[model samples]
Target chain A: MPIRVKLDERMREKGMSLTELADRVGLTLANLSILKTGKAKAVRFSTLEAICKALECKPGDLLDFDEE
Target chain B: MKQSSLSLRVLKLVLTVCWWGSVIMAVLVPLALVYAASSSGNPKSDWEFSYTGYASGIDTSSLSAVDRDGREGRVEFNEGTWVQVFYPIETSAGRVKLVLLIAVVSGVVLAFFLVFIKQLKDILDTVSEGDPFVEVNAGRVRLIGVLLIVGTFGQALLRLVVSGYADSSLRTTGFQLDGNFEMNFMQLIAGVSVLVLSEVFRLGTKMREEQELTV
Candidate 1:
């Protein structure tokens, strides 16, 4: 939970919608929604690679560690 | 792929029947006792507490046995073991006590059995639905395990109390009432096993949730 997902900010910067990113990354919209909403328990490396490649960004750009 | 299992369905049916049966018994047992007590005009000799007792002294010398050869012979006993005695309730108060004892014992047993069956049915329902990793199922299993352990010990204590009550009231010269109270290792083991299983379920639920939420 401390690892915050900045997917919304990254997606906004890329000018892409969740459905578009899901289609590009080969992920379901529901799963993308979970990541965007910071509810995902884990992000697989392959999924991260696909999302990063689709969005043309690093994993660090979409993820942040917030110390509680 | 949530394919329905026929065996699970049959087991659910059996559990349903058992649940209803326990429910019926919970309602009927005390009623039956009350009816028996009320209907018998002279209930003193009719009602009795059946208990096992140890008899002392040398009564085996006079004991006779009939073999299959139709020859009667004296039987020798090595050790004076337990003897089943149906001690009659001679007084109205005693009969009332006996009825109350029966009612309480049956109530406890049926109550535990009902809850146990209900919990089991709930777990089975989850299993049948192909979602046995739910967290609630773990709680249910834990509850059943605790119930089993508690019920076993509680029944033993109740038996002891009833036997003590009988011992205090029944003033027979030769018979000493034995409560037949013993620790049930099997039920305890079963309860502990279920508790362990509940832990396993907890872990499974956690793992499942983690897997589901992983993106």
Candidate 2:
């Protein structure tokens, strides 16, 4: 839970909608939304690779670690 | 995969039948008891039973019966004693009281069985639907285990109380019978086993949730 997904922040920075990102990454909108809302328990390496490639950013740019 | 195997279906059918049967009995038994107690022409007035002590206590040394080896030694219970007693319920008041006691005791025991069967049926429903790893199944299994353990102890307590009540009123000439309570180890072990299985299901449920949430 401490490893938070900054998908929404990165998406906003790139001015890309969730549907557009999901279509580019070949993932369903629901799954992409799950990641965006920080509800996903894990992000697969392939999924991370796809997201990083589509957004033109590193995995670190889409993820943050905050200790509660 | 869905668990629609023939054996599973048959077992589920049998359990459903048993649950309905128990439900019917739970309703009918008290009515029958009350009717029997109220009827003036009651068929039976006295109840008698003989039970041997659970442990070895009977003296078999004097018996001449031979064993498989053809020796004078026979099956020995050197410490076992068989106690036989006649319990009289001659009066209408006594009969009514007995009926009330039976109804209460049986109601509690039957309630336990009904809940256990219902929970089991629910689990089977989930399994049949190929969704057995839900968290509620773990809770239901845990409840069955707790019920089994508690029901065993409750049975022992009921036996003690009923026997003690019987012994207090019945007059005897030579020997007196006491209420003896014994723990049922088998049921306790079974309950513990189910509890362990519930924990395993809980782990499975957690793993399933994690798997589902992974993107």
Candidate 3:
């Protein structure tokens, strides 16, 4: 299973880096990297909300379900 | 950074030494006895004769006569033979007693060590279960140490008595005082080491408790 994360596209469109997003969301770079790479088993709702708010995007804009 | 407790480590060391020492003795004592028995020739053939009748019962009238010098004499039966009979001397009884004493003392020492090891393992288990504040009984360790010391000393004394008896009865009894003394000394040292390590473990437990309280 793969969770297609559009973090790279969102960050590019917003002219922000992963470090900047991690700082905004009060998360570590490693955790943010896991989420961006779709390596996370599941993201907490609070963490997802924080990421969406920091990215100024909807959850649908950040996540996509793809069979792997 | 969790390390094993000092008492537990010492207990393991003592048990290992005790087990190995017993194994070596069990092998060596029988070998020594076999070597001693084999070197003295065939004891069965040399010591199986029984004295029956004396030479006075022999009939001299029917025997052939042989004369030498100016005297004539009749030859009687001459079947005298020298045999060496090995018997359990008085000293062997004392040695048996000493061996019994050593066995009893070793049993007591082993029992004490077992109990101490079990108690130490229990304490370690409790610590591993995240109960650092659990009360440890130092008295148990102390009691076991005392018992071990007493048992070891008793074994040493018994060995000394056996050696003394052997010296008096068996003329060629080769007794090595060094080995027995060293074993006894090591046993004493191990007991004392356990006691000291238990004290150190108690201190470590107290420090851990204090840290937890401050946290």
Candidate 2: list runs displaced more than 4 Å. Answer: A1-4, A64-68, B40-84, B162-179
Identify the candidate with maximal TM-score: 1
Which lDDT tens digits does candidate 3 get at residues B48-125? 222111112334565565566656576754642222224432343444454455455555555555565566555555
Which stretch of 10 consecutive residues in model 1 chain B shows the poorest summed lDDT? B52-61
Each model's lDDT comes to 0.81, 0.80, 0.60
Clash pairs, model 2 backbone: B56-B79, B56-B80, B57-B79, B57-B80, B58-B77, B58-B79, B58-B80
TM-score of chain B of 1: 0.77
How far off is residue B56 in model 3, in Å? 47
What is the C-alpha lDDT profile of model 2 across B1-215, one tens digit per residue?
77779989998999999899999999899889867667824656463233322222444455677768877755655442435454555666766776776788788878888999999999999989988889999999999999989988987886666566656656554445467686798998999999999999999999989898899
Interface RMSD of each: 0.3, 0.4, 13.5
On DockQ, the leading prediction is: 1
Clashes of each: 0, 7, 0
For model 1, what is the error of residue A6's alpha carbon versus the real structure, in angstroms, after optimal superposition?
0.6
Clashing pairs in 1: none
TM-score of every model versus the real structure: 0.83, 0.81, 0.33
Q: Write the per-residue lDDT of candidate 1 for residues B13-118, one digit (tens) a residue.
A: 8999999988888878878998877754574346666764444344555578889999999776565455555766677777777788778767777877888898
Q: How close to the true structure is residue B9 of candidate 2, measured as C-alpha lDDT?
A: 91
